[model samples]
Target: MSLPLPLIFDYEEIAGKFYPVIPIELKVNEKRFLTRAYVDSGATFSIFNAEIADYLGLDYRKGDKIYPAGIGGHICAYIKDIFISIHNIEICCEVLFSDEFTVKFNLLGRAGIFDRFRVCFDDSEKKLYLYEKAYSDFR
Candidate 1:
């Protein structure tokens, strides 16, 4: 079975806060899990909460330490490889693992996943397309 392409929603800023939440289904260790992740173009890598990794039975010890920061400050995180799929497209890449105190869901960043796909934001349709290649070749 194939998964549908990602649905992109227009990010709106409330007060001075920017909310860029995107719905995503993550496949790890042959297990499927669904959650909403914040799409952050500014981030260099994708990150997932430790609780999610534990629930999915992902091996935490295989990960390496990486430092990431939020509004509060910088924190040490673990980075590991996982299989990510969207719209029948699957790719193996490294993702960051953070303790529950940091975040709840995954954070889709610029490297790994996003770098592999040609992404287009259709403001008119309010959808995000992850093209196998470029937008012109997308079906």
Candidate 2:
């Protein structure tokens, strides 16, 4: 099935440019938080601010630890399974929570999402096409 997601136009003062952001709901058991996240194909794993995990009352540090590096430097993060709702489609996946990731937006990356859907970014239309793959499609 093909699901087209409408992106929210977010303007960044530093870049003076607008980018497409996706609205997602993060949930841990009974707790749920709605927020916008950058759909980044370059990122290996979905990463969220530690504050979000705290908001969900998660003991984030108990998860596996890893140091993910970027242009700025490496930062500590913990991997944990959480449910993400995109367009009301809920999926449980592993994500990283970090205190040092101070970016303005959370990231929906390759690990969990890309593995399940074929993502097409239509920059001109400012939208994302998420095509859900059947089990046979996985090689």
Model 2 clash number: 0
Worst 10 residues of 1 by lDDT: 130-139
Candidate 2, run of 10 with poorest lDDT: 5-14
Q: Estimate TM-scores for all models.
A: 0.71, 0.84
Candidate 1 per-residue lDDT over residues 1-139, each given as its tens digit: 4533544456544466556666667777678887777776777888887888888888775788767877778877888887776545666778888774366546788766666665666555545555455434332
Candidate 2 local Cα displacement, residue 93, angstroms? 1.0
Tens-digit lDDT track for model 2 on 1-139? 5444432343322375555477889999999999988889999999999999999999999999999998899999999999998877677889999999999789988887887777777666655677765666743
Each candidate's number of clashing pairs is: 0, 0
lDDT of each: 0.69, 0.82
Best by TM-score: 2
Clashing pairs in 1: none
RMSD of each: 5.7, 3.3
